[model samples]
Target: MVGGGALVRKPASPVGPLALLHRPVPEPPSSLRRGPLREGAWRSPLRSERTATLLGMWVGVAFAVCFATGLLSHLIQNPPSWFGWPSRPVNLYRVTQGLHVISGFAAIPLLLAKLWTVYPKLFEWPPVRSLLHAIGRLSLLVLVGSAIFQLVTGVLNVARWYVVMPFFFTTAHYWTAWIAIGAILVHVGSKLAIIRIGLSEPAAAEPPAAAVAGGLTRRSFLTAVAATSGVVALTTAGQTVPALSGITVFGQRDPRLGLQGLPVNKSAASAGVLETAVDPTHRITLDGPRPQQLSLAVLRSLPQHTVRLPITCVEGWSATADWTGIRMADLLDMMGLPEDAEVTVESLQESGLYRASVLAPPHSRDPLTLLALRLNGADLHIDHGYPARLIAPNRPGVLQTKWVSRVRAL
Candidate 1:
């Protein structure tokens, strides 16, 4: 009688709803019968090798992103704003400049790993020795050399460091980077055949012939990837997380940090004539024949001004430092130089781009700008123009002259 009653009531114990809720949803029947998934459903297994090659080219692609953003940054930073560059009516250089530096910095380990993986292939002999070999060798050399130079300079720039070399890395860095692009183009363009051969038939693609010959395998490659990523993560955490900075197991030469510093001139006198004297006797001659040395102490004693200015470089990089020094306008006032007269900042370093002197316009008199003597709440490093340097808001680092001994107001 109970069973008959349950059937009559359609089993209304909520069991059916609960069963419906708990049951797994079935996958929709694929249109692909036994052959393959629909066009988008399943990519051919052959594409795996192609995928690897493309992944391997990621470093080169990163370099391209850096160069484009960096060059774009330079034009925007310019006073006149040439080449249809974005006008900084709202200071857009901040975004692009950051992209440039971040992109440049991130490329460090990517490039290293990519190079390590592909370098072995360079020794592979051509089936037929000819121009391809010569071209490939030359392209590899240019790519590797350019990449090293670019990344080294890039990482140091992020650290707010400089050497007694080129101040206008924007012009020189951009110029060389463009050359790098050309080299990369040749590298890619020349290797299209080989890349195509490997990638065209991903299904047919097996272990890279060279890698197999060298006893490398996908498993080994994966292990290397895991190791590289771990190191990078540790490196990143140490930098961003102050807590981890204490447990720096790695030495000072952080792989992620790249080279520790820029080239500095030890012979260049670190002691400036300005630092040696006191306030009363010190006189700053500006817009005059020469800078009348004034007591920077006196300038400090008057009113302490602080502008946290970030020096952005055209090479797609930037660094922030607390700028503390006499205002360019005040210096002009002290020197009795005309407000309109242009003051040229000459670095101890030679020009890497042009033959003639690079000049910062008279607009440097802006109150926000100052001759910086300190960085990050401390004394400037010798590697970073020890005694004095120029700090301007949003100007490329090259324009921020280092090892600045002479500020002639002409």
Candidate 2:
């Protein structure tokens, strides 16, 4: 019996819902609990402000090299009215483009390490403490995203994986680089004071807990990152530096292997110019003040000049060969065109976008610019532009029109 204020007892059945409800509630696991945000949790013993700052410095240097070299390559491919690239140092384009690729590759690991070092900051509470802070974070996101995009697309281009890209790799990569560099500049400017402090401070010793765990130390981690970058450079630099060819397991092209001991980016068959390129009746039509149609035999009979020049591709592989052909200046002279006249070189590869390229006045006037008939003292390989090709100094290999059919002076 129970009174008005008294509780009534029920038979305890372990399988029943009432019995189960009476059982004590289990506590949550320690890992599932949310502890207060603390410095110790946010900062890894292996990573510190000093470590991040040092990594940032190295990353900055790599970016600087990449930017300068990339700009030079772009200029070589697309010269302005005032810019006159030199032709004497035949390997100038090769060196600059090589540096651009290698520096870009080296930046990968450094960027990853730097990101890891500061990753905890991404989860910082009160994320937008101020307008400036919010802007800084946004800028960082853009910089990181652009940097990754540029690096990935660049690598894909080097590997000749055109299927992966939705747009033209060159145009996308070029514009993205500008955005990435601009974000980097803004970030550095905003964080100048903090960066100075971090860099000036001496590296902290490993915490006791970290030492007891016996994992990678901060110094060891940095060494590993740097070693990774060096390994990447060694494996890819062989495409440009012949000495490293043996160890270049990852190189896209072998400098010593191709139609005439040089790598070929595009073949006659792929370019759809094989028929016309090998046709004996194919003649080069020069359209200028005095329009002229000259057969290959007749063009070959003209004054031939031999020039040793390196063909540097946008992908960064380059090879030097003795090209025998008529000087473009001589051709212009025969046409009675002015010395400052610009010329348009058209290729028999009719379907491609780069089938035609324009030579500025300086390039047209340069004696190194040739309508090449032979390479390396041998008849040009069908794959290497059999009938004729344009070999110009300090120009990207893509701009070197192959299977030449016409040259018009402007």
Candidate 3:
């Protein structure tokens, strides 16, 4: 039998490794049809291709729903700060936006199954198939690829807040997702024929091989991957679920947040940022065209604005903060920071590797731009980017740039 554990196979050709390797893996002989046929819901008798096709299509539908919802949620939560969607109550954006993550997770098994059924047609290549057929097959592959990326980065985002290893999901995840979605659309449009095939066919035409592998087919590998995605979600869920709120495992929670877990600096003491002294001498800075620079005194003295904004992470976790920093725009205004100005931020602790920042002019001008020195109200914690850190409403947590030491606008 082959490594995959299948039926018999023909002998290998003479000469090389194939000849020496007595059928490293054996597949069932072409004549063998070992398993009893399966009956799908759409089959005339629930055993045909119709049933399988229908089931696969429905799974596809579930994936489609998740994709659309998740994308909208992303746009909303990470909107241009001044961004708006439809004429609906803009207040519901966060709630509606949550659907992107939750539902995206739920689509795992469905999308996998949908692909499993259609993928067989994909290898019918080298035959110069119709343009649409080729496009459709390519699309499905890309969708699967994209879905994988989304899950990976989404998981990483959670790891960041959870303080798990291999941090950096905030930046990496955002970039990959854009590529994934384009692939999704191509796969979806090509499936119109498959949907019709499901609706019109009789039973018995379905394929049993199409059943997703585990949980009696109720929960496939896709489900396992995404369902387990909740590890990060669970880490963050302390705030949402009372039962889970206080329980601590290896201390992932922030004692201050009161429940929902917050990421810790793991090396707060070693993080090396001195927050003990809000020394006026330790001035804030904003460097400008021709390297013009100013002290925090100068920044605060220029013009100040305060905003109550939350830093939401892609890991499906969030934290609200009252940020009090100079309006990025006002500071930039001091040096005439360009609309395309790129800024670099530094922390007091020469220890942190972070250093560059970008200021989206007129954009950062919003009242939400804050250089918070406090959290919830009090001075910022040593672990939470103390002394001061840049917080922006227009960006994901990654872009906020903690541990400020310098700001270079170029």
Candidate that scores best on TM-score = 2
TM-score of 1: 0.52
Model 2 residue runs over 4 Å out of place are 1-39, 130-132, 203-213
State how far residue 10 of model 3 sits from its true place (Å). 34
What C-alpha lDDT do the candidate models reach, one value each? Answer: 0.53, 0.83, 0.50
- Give TM per candidate: 0.52, 0.86, 0.55
The local lDDT score (0 to 100) that residue 297 gets in candidate 2 is 91
Ten-residue stretch with the least lDDT total in model 3: 37-46
lDDT of 1 by residue, 1-410 (tens): 42464433455433465554434444444432233223333422222435445544766777887888776665644435334432122234545655565556656766776665564355343312444345556667787887777877666554446673366544556677877777878777876876785467544345666636765455455446546645644553333233444543321222123112222222234334233222244343333643465444654564445776655444333334466765776666665666666666655444333111223443456677676666666656655554556666555555667655456765
State the lDDT of candidate 2 residue by residue for 40-89, as single tens digits: 46545767767788888888888888888887777877877677787656
Arrange candidates by lDDT, descending: 2, 1, 3
Q: RMSD of each candidate?
A: 18.0, 13.4, 10.7
- For candidate 3, the per-residue lDDT at 154 reads 56
Q: How many steric overlaps does candidate 3 have? A: 32
